[model samples]
Target chain A: MNSNTRPVADPRPAFVENPEQADQQQALGRRIITDGIRTVFLVGCGGSLAAYGPSVYTLDNRVPQLVVQAMNSDEFNYRKPAGLGPTSIVLVGSHTGTTAETVRAIDTAKAAGAESVVSLTSDPESPLATHADLAFTDRPTKWAWDPKEIAMARITQGILDAAGLAASGFDEALAALPADIPNVFADLDPALHRIAEDLATKPVTYALGSGPMEGMARAFAMFYMQEMLWRHAAAYNAGEFLHGPFEMTESQAPYLVLCGEDATRPMTDRALGFLNRYSEHVHVIDSREFRLAGVPDGVRAEIAPIVMSAVTTRLAQHLEAVLDHDLSTRRYMFSVEY
Target chain B: MNSNTRPVADPRPAFVENPEQADQQQALGRRIITDGIRTVFLVGCGGSLAAYGPSVYTLDNRVPQLVVQAMNSDEFNYRKPAGLGPTSIVLVGSHTGTTAETVRAIDTAKAAGAESVVSLTSDPESPLATHADLAFTDRPTKWAWDPKEIAMARITQGILDAAGLAASGFDEALAALPADIPNVFADLDPALHRIAEDLATKPVTYALGSGPMEGMARAFAMFYMQEMLWRHAAAYNAGEFLHGPFEMTESQAPYLVLCGEDATRPMTDRALGFLNRYSEHVHVIDSREFRLAGVPDGVRAEIAPIVMSAVTTRLAQHLEAVLDHDLSTRRYMFSVEY
Candidate 1:
């Protein structure tokens, strides 16, 4: 566990205090089903949308009644979904709630026939939250566990419940998820520091995961490593990595494999074995190693990705510490308009 | 454009001579509609699935009646879709038709109720083709504009046609498409060599596009660069690049932007502008530059991705020449099993 720097804030704490917000969001989700909403567009940009991948996959597989689609903010705003309109629910996800495309997508969604809008963000004051029909806000953190993700899961649960496909007591299980910010570095896991130290100056790095954890692995490599740390890195699905990306692997290039306990563990384990053979710097972050305090075994598989994010959040920060790079450094994000 | 090497064969030449095969596939697609197939699961692994991206996007937005789902072979094999069954069509895509997950996915799809199966591959004797109810075979090509991709497009066209959801005269336009193998080097485009020279030694390269071109862009980066050239690279959607990935776009890093002439052109153009200001190595490949011979304007819009693939296939080969890297060079692909 990391202890030298301030721990990243948990986005879920504010949700515990404002339990009504979840209820309101859940009611909105259920209403969408009851009201005959034809489509639910889970809309956002970059990290916001990538983070919702697991939820989308779950929602698509679990609730087959509703046509669930994830749209990129700019494309959603540029041409927009033809199916969007009064009977469509556009759920806009933006951590800052200030992403220009997502902010515009809310209005665009409505203009395109979005009758119900659910804004998931950290800032209630942001344009998206201010204008949405239901605003699910949590305490803001630039790079941390997305509290709104949990809220989105709850909302999706309500949708499932209304559709008569709820995963027996899934809502209660979701509500019971820990609200406490994790001490990811409290134990100072050697793997975390080892990856950061070894990859401090590596020319390029790769991360891999499968199942719902693919999103978390992507966030770690694309968001935290490339976006925050400005490191040269890439992320691939564990299965696809062997199919094509293995050629790029060598002794110098490191592979950070996120071995989450899920249906795809064997595939990732195979990747790890291959990386271990070919690459000198193979960092493995297995969810089984970390004690996810207060997280029940029932909801653990579904939420393992959320746990992976919290763990990698610390790893990204530790990487910054080793490289002497500030996470706040930016090149044209919020600083300049495209 | 490329004069020194043998021109890559167009995969559709056999289709012209074997017209009855297409009629058989079209009859199958029509039967899918007649039989009331409710869902279409377009399944494949990395490059195979990535290549069908444009067709899928077009089908998704255009053919709203059918639930069109694209699934990874491993994911589909592990947690087969609950919606799969006799009312569903599983279109298995693999260049070699030897992908293990895909082979299992076919049986899983059948077990889950896939009544009609369409196997798209180069080898008719392959496991997927041998087991599938309908196999659409094309002549094989490795690390080039996938021959299977053309076959997949025709099958999708037939599916769209059966549903009466196809664009106006789309089939006529498709039939008129030239069978002439694209001499991507006919014009001897310098940009291909420029991109290869610029990125020959770059530690990391980023590729981006939208719509069907997004898949082509992904294939070029993941399949061509990483898998074929043994180069380190990553690919992302054009619109998403601005939301977070811009942070990694330093002056030194090259950004290969595929600006296709589609609805998403403006979005890619916006990204190109941003990359121009930030990165020195910004390679833009726009489909409008290449005139796909004998293709009508109406079909060109939909078939632009096939054209894009043809154009970039040369770029991949050119990169090999500049880097002196053989396209067949592999660490584990066919040489060893994982």
Candidate 2:
């Protein structure tokens, strides 16, 4: 497939035609979130929950009084920690609402006297939604490059709106995303493609970053690189990169760093400089431009990282596709216990 | 060497015997933290900050007025986000205290008007410590294990004490850790040793858990399996294990899960159950016994997970040693760039 063309397996429908549906869902999510809940608890399992961390951190920092907890439903239902009260608002995210523990969590929260529940899921009719006070459907088609990115973008915006925080910028960002992402990916495609192509034959790979982006680097390196590309890859934070990982770097070894625009930028730059000193195999996705200049005014700079994250990841998906890696074809190595 | 035998290179002597020194350094850290008046930003690179997430979350949730921000210093210094004041506290951590970016972060924080600096380092003479207003030293000789765990325990206690909250039990728990950890590791040594021996030749491994223990599992698996053993490994929360990892769980893959005594026990159990259905090649370090029966009573159950984390990790360390892995052989696969 050509770099600019959509993949043959493009499963997601274009968002242009469904403007009304997106707006309605966004409005509903906002209403549910803004209505009388002093604190918000986002609950999910696995990647779903992992994805919520940045959003939670963003929202929590923006509105210090808004308590955001990323609790795995399985843990909440099983461990039952103290401090939850009737005033707490529970936001549950499960791609498939059929996740048993998530469904049980909603039920448990209601029983425990939670004030409200907001469910984010791909399946509107999933059990969690059925029990939820409000549900935000995340229906991204499988072939939309990175479906989770779009889903998380929407979910994050909805959560922010619900908190009475300004989310129009995020809404605007996502609306322009389909157009912006492809360009960003096109720009970085060559580098990532080279990395991906080389990674295809490598026995191992590492993705390094610092700050909030560490989790992203890890997810991509471990999940995408290993799962999609079937390669051995590891992720490290820029600071920790030197503690022990530097010794593993050599002329033949390749690593990628996600240098997002954050306080960690300088440190990451220095760390990357050190890496470059050791070997020329290091590649970095300089996110400073998108991080500082890309976001529209009035949007919290802290949250800008989220959008920049979207762009970088979009590039990652293109690179993966260029390498002809299929995410669906990979089978999970282990069954989820709960 | 027998499991009971200590390594000749044990670095514990330099730090452990000098509790008063540690206390003095901690006091200095508190002074820097307090004197750095504008904002208190807790900067850490990767696992160092992540290990402190729960505590940061707690502080943010309970004391919103503190102006505490946990970020990777690498991002902070480079991005140069405005609002950093001279009174700001930049708390950075680098085990060796020589991470280039971290050192730069201290410099940037100072330039940004950060008046006081505090650092956690295994090497008291490292640049980060030398430059800091206060520094906590934890000079562990063995690279196989991290002393940050102890530093974090101390830091968390200090935070609690500073906040005037009830922290007596937590303090006691920290004191009891050294003895408890070695004992638990000795008991679980045989099982872990056998598993390590079997997996010595394996190319990849996965560590699974949920809740706070999830981070611990990831840190250990990545450090031991990837760094020490030079084998590939990934860590995932139990709840997410089934999402994409199950496919790799054929009879050939090796998986380890840490089942700590936390609210996630049920989820961990459920995860274990699911993994059992897919494959029998799973190992577990059940930590409930240590939490419930072994820990002293005054410690809060909420903190039990943190206390028992040492035990579980010690087991992992023993396993690596038993498998004839050299704890000091440092491998660098990549360097961090700013």
- Evaluate residue A84 in candidate 2 and report its C-alpha lDDT on the 0 to 100 scale: 50
lDDT score of residue A60 within candidate 2: 47
Distance from true position, residue B162, model 1, in Å?
A: 3.4
Give the TM-scores of the predictions, in the order they appear.
Answer: 0.91, 0.74
State which candidate has the highest DockQ.
1
Candidate 1 CAPRI classification by DockQ: medium
Evaluate chain B of model 1: give its TM-score: 0.90
Off by over 4 Å in 1: A1-17, A82-87, A139-144, A164-185, B1-17, B140-144, B172-184
Error of 1 at A65 (Å): 1.8
**Docking verdict class for candidate 2:** acceptable
RMSD of each: 3.6, 6.2
Summarize candidate 1's per-residue lDDT along B274-303 as a digit string, tens digits. 889888889888777665566666666787
Q: Write the per-residue lDDT of candidate 1 for residues A1-338, one digit (tens) a residue.
A: 22354433322222342678778867877887899987888888877887677677677666656778888887777656556777788889988888888988878887876787888888889888998877878754433455767777777777877988766646554554454234444554456767788887687888998877777788887788888887877888888888888887788878788877766678788788888888888888887775656556665666667667667777876687777677778878878879
Weakest ten-residue segment in model 1 chain B by summed lDDT? B8-17
